[model samples]
Target chain A: MAEDHKMTYADPWMLPETKGFWEALNDGKLVIRTCNDCGRGHHFPRAMCPHCYSSNLEWKESDGTGTIYSFTAQQVKGGGKYVYAYVEIADRVRAITNIVDCDPDALQIGQKVKAAFRPSASGQNILVFTPA
Target chain B: MTAHDARLVGAYELPYRHAPDKSLAQMQAEAALGAVADAGLSLKDVDGFFCGGDTPGMGPMSLIEYLNITPRYVDSTETGGNSYVSHVARAARAIDAGLCDVALITLAGKPRTPAKGSRPMTDSNKPDQDFELTYHPTVPANYALAAQRHMYEYGTTSEQLAWIKVAASHHAQHNPHALLKDVVTVEDVVNSPMVASPLHRFDCCVITDGGGALILAKSEIAKRLNRPSVKILGTGEAVKHQGAGDIDLTWTAGKWAAEKAWKMSGCTPDQIQYASIYDSFTITVLLEIEDLGFCKPGHGGGFVAEGNLISGKGKLPFNTDGGGLCSNHPGNRGGMTKVIEAVRQLRGEAHPAVQVPDCALALAHGTGGSLGTRHGASTLILARED
Candidate 1:
């Protein structure tokens, strides 16, 4: 992705727990924690399985494709527009991301989308979504 | 053994709308004193304390030292806007267990005043901060996602959502303390500037500075307080997720909480005369009404559109104090206001213009956190003693 095309904002690359996820994004992969015990996947990576409370977890790469569970077009004061949405990934897990490369108003619920890495204001790669 | 055996003997709201001059502790003190007096008790009689707010920093200790009272039991459960209603259930449980006799639950904040550094209080270091904040989703935007999905799945319309604000404004016309007194039409709500898709500016809640307090006493102490006591029939609390994308957006924890409350209270949904639902957003009220069994899934939009939530015209009156949409929000969880209004309705003390006639049973429901990503729901049933 070109630097100019990237959305500028504070990135969470500094968080020790999520450093690996950010590193994966930089390597062109979208990853989440899949609990080994429960055999389920989750987002915003956690130390323990939220569903089963099992510390048995591993990092797994997602196919980076999902459906827009829901979304909103935020019209900024300076005439800028951004589409924010919750993308439902595997096993009903949802990830909050920005929808890019399309008109904000054109975004729809249940629309198919895939992840795209873009440079953040903090000079780190962050994951955003685009129409698949 | 049940909430029915306990009573909320006192209720008070600190000055609503604007209180820029007062510190958080000062507002809480005023509300706490007012509630203590309303219950015909003194500070010395308060044996338990429960409070939740972002301001004042130190949790129970700040209020405890500021108010200069020590209690044996303290609960500082800070679950978004549903904290106060959640406290009611916890307080009742403590009192019933004989761990504490007289308990005070309070909430206060000054979100409108920059001098107090209170701006829609939120923790900066929460686990979900990394992902959720990166998209720059405002509170309305988060909730708008749920609203959009509801429209797509259930064919709910923006006009239907507008009615929730319209009805709240209609009730606000009669509330002297309500911040927005001007009656608003459905057209006004829909025509308002869009904050996010599927939700207009009017569809969101107001930001203000205020505080509220409630005093709960054992039935014996409540009976001798020389004031009308509203019995806490039953209460329920639940959390579905901390951040979004796990659970079904169309359903809420209210489905489980309200059912638990009804079973414990021995009161059916049809028997509820009034409802004090948390109105952080118009869609919130709609989803809660459905989850609480007032109507079936996918029927909330039409149910609210039929004017069922209006003060007098509808069978189930809601947000009789103008609700958070038009009333005071104060940056705290809204459950306190809901409880206060339910008490007033059951006591026949609500403004005559908005009071439900012969209201015997009332339901106070609250939702906390982002409705799209994560949320908590609390339900409390209150009734008058015959």
Candidate 2:
């Protein structure tokens, strides 16, 4: 894994609005932004609902359960083999995350997965998925 | 006839794959001179200017100030690789509105050896960087995510996707300046190293230094000039995103752009003698081919298999100049080269080996930004008027 020489933050820079989500992740709890109006959910949490544009959004705790919507393990030239995937979390929120604790080649679509916090190469707690 | 119509009277592509000594401005000027002269016009004749973010100094003025001519109109729309193709539609609309007489659009890039600090891995201030950057959204990986979903939804196979690269290699053999001139087969592609799961190394486009220019003149100027008339029949551009989380990874926004183009030109896919679909990746062509209405949805894989896109062999010939997959795609923003090749095919100036015979109507398309994330797509339908 190569690092961009210019990155200022080894860990995520949390904004006031996103503080709750980041704090929850570090606390060994997972959460998603749920819309009160539409009863739908989204990831990369935002203040307003992406589906209905309603400001009545709340952070609901998730059990880290989801299905593998799609995935690709990229092998860069002279670089590490990385497994990136889209996990369709419960409540219809699709999350793009890395898969861990398993062989990269063994991943498949429609498989069950559960989110877990693991240390990345940069020595920061990161979200990843494993075969449930 | 309305005085607003425009004709592409000049087209020029620089003959270089790696020009480390030349700066972006130098390449732009060289290609600009070649295009303007090819149109039987001079720099003084250019009254409108257009460029993309690749322009170095200051917006479109990097070239505008360098050439020392103040155009009556200017447009600096940036859509990554698709910017140049979108500029074609913008220039035509500007000319139709009597905004300018000669619209000159130029593109030049040197991604093979970028200037230090010019290529940043991540924008520190981009709003979503904190969320999406962690997943390692490398260019091919982002697209591979889409390929995976397409395979799941439509059953698109790697072999079917390999045909696109096969088509580009088939045409690249005819191009003297193409970077990868050797022809490749489906077996060769699938057997190559896998850069991303489902997308082998052959599935990606080559990165090379390149620059190309196009001069669209008022119809009257085109008539007086000695160049063949390449009419701008119709053009359309659109941006597609995740649609508020209701995203379908298999589809692209190109469908909307193509609809607008087809409605404006009154030309269906069957009437198009030559097609220049952008080739950022193999799956890109499959999606665009289906989106452009050349085949039914989910049928592009079968439509392109079995040498169906080769010049003399297939009913629909595409990328006779090798496209981005084999030839030059300046700065990796390939939209400019798409239109350049379409003009070549329309003018009968393509290489003798791959030239489409009596190419009367041609379509050139481009997709830029990231296909997985938010991106832009453009479509242009051109004609060689009798």
Candidate 3:
């Protein structure tokens, strides 16, 4: 059979460079931004430190652990339910992410969670926090 | 410039004329220039600048490069629609602190982007890396989810949300420049196509290219100006959460901002004769009505649906200029439009048809982003004479 002409090529610019965040996920570790100047760590990693405005920063692999700060269960029509979380990692850093591998209603604040990477569409992976 | 004794000495707003073809930058410059002229000042007097991140040239550094104005204090805070109102207070404080004598706060429409049909999703920054984008949960879907929650918790019907759009459209009928000038009924809103669950096409705000600006100066300078000074009695900003995961989507950080603004302005909810709550979605206004203490929690659906939000007989009139729901809302410019309406009502210059009767105390509020995530609210309290 001839190749279907229905397939369209994805744009080159569409690829997101998330290897840094995903690489740590593959290693069963969570990575966050740690500032050398102020000794603070943050989720949603950035090249420059937000607290001290220091460009000098390093990546610290988390203990694959954290506690839930807060969360919300979202239900979209035609889409299943899922709970998003505010997780507090080491060094007083908090991030808004998702807690997976658990029932949405069973989620609790201060629940211990560990990092896990799961395969996603397009040969990529995502970081999901599960109860430790 | 003095201490942090910031006050809104003057404000200006132009009608929301639809100009989808104009570039965002041109609209921004026009608005800024008009505001300066209205204040009887010149751009040369502007020493500080603030604007929304969505503008053509945004960020403190980027806008300065684009506008070619060397502002001592420059900020491009992007908290969505409320950014303008919050920037107003921030610029006012900057002016009072002597950081700048005249501050220019302006925002234009969202510049069109080619790749995504709209601006890339926030999570697009980490697309291959971010999981949320994979679900295709754009803002409309996010708002749809929140609207569902509101319906679940408060028995808030889709019809209730439609009432806000109906009331806003009613006001827009008198506003010649309003994009949706025709009056609509609750039935019309319900029958409209559902863009997302619980939100119809009519429930959403219109997108048009426009700009607005306000020139804030010290009291000494404002006192001598020819135009009536719309003294900024108080300004406050609050963020409920940086993202949708933190707060109860039904409640908002707007409550906190209003708490501070009302306390500082020395006014109570009962004193406010008119209000301008951002109407990105009809549900947003419903949430603000309750959050701002205008009505009890879980009563927003009733407050708006039962004709309380309409002008004249209503205890608190809202969006006399049609609002984002029925007016031309070019992204973050909605907030500035709200403030301008309040100032005009205070000055008794609102178009005769939509003018609030004897408007003495006014409240303007704005919120951006979907429910439960990164909510931004700015509340401003203004009095005719302070």
Query: Who wins the DockQ comparison?
Result: 1
User: Taking the tens digit of each residue's C-alpha lDDT, what string does model 2 give over B255-289?
Assistant: 98999898888889999999999888898889999
Runs of candidate 2 exceeding 4 Å displacement = A1-9, A90-92, A120-124, B1-4
Ranking by lDDT: 2, 1, 3
CA RMSD, predictions in order: 2.7, 3.0, 7.4
Model 3 chain B is weakest, by summed lDDT over 10 consecutive residues, at: B127-136
TM-score, structure 1 vs. true: 0.94
In model 2, which residue pairs have backbone atoms overlapping below 3 Å?
none
Residue B220 error, candidate 2, Å: 1.8
Give each prediction's DockQ, rounded to 2 decimals: 0.63, 0.53, 0.08
Candidate 1 CAPRI-style tier: medium
| Candidate 1 local lDDT, residue B126 | 79
- Model 1, B8-63: lDDT tens digits are 99999875678877877888888899999988999899999998755376779988
Give all candidates' CA lDDT scores.
0.85, 0.85, 0.72
CAPRI quality band, candidate 2: medium
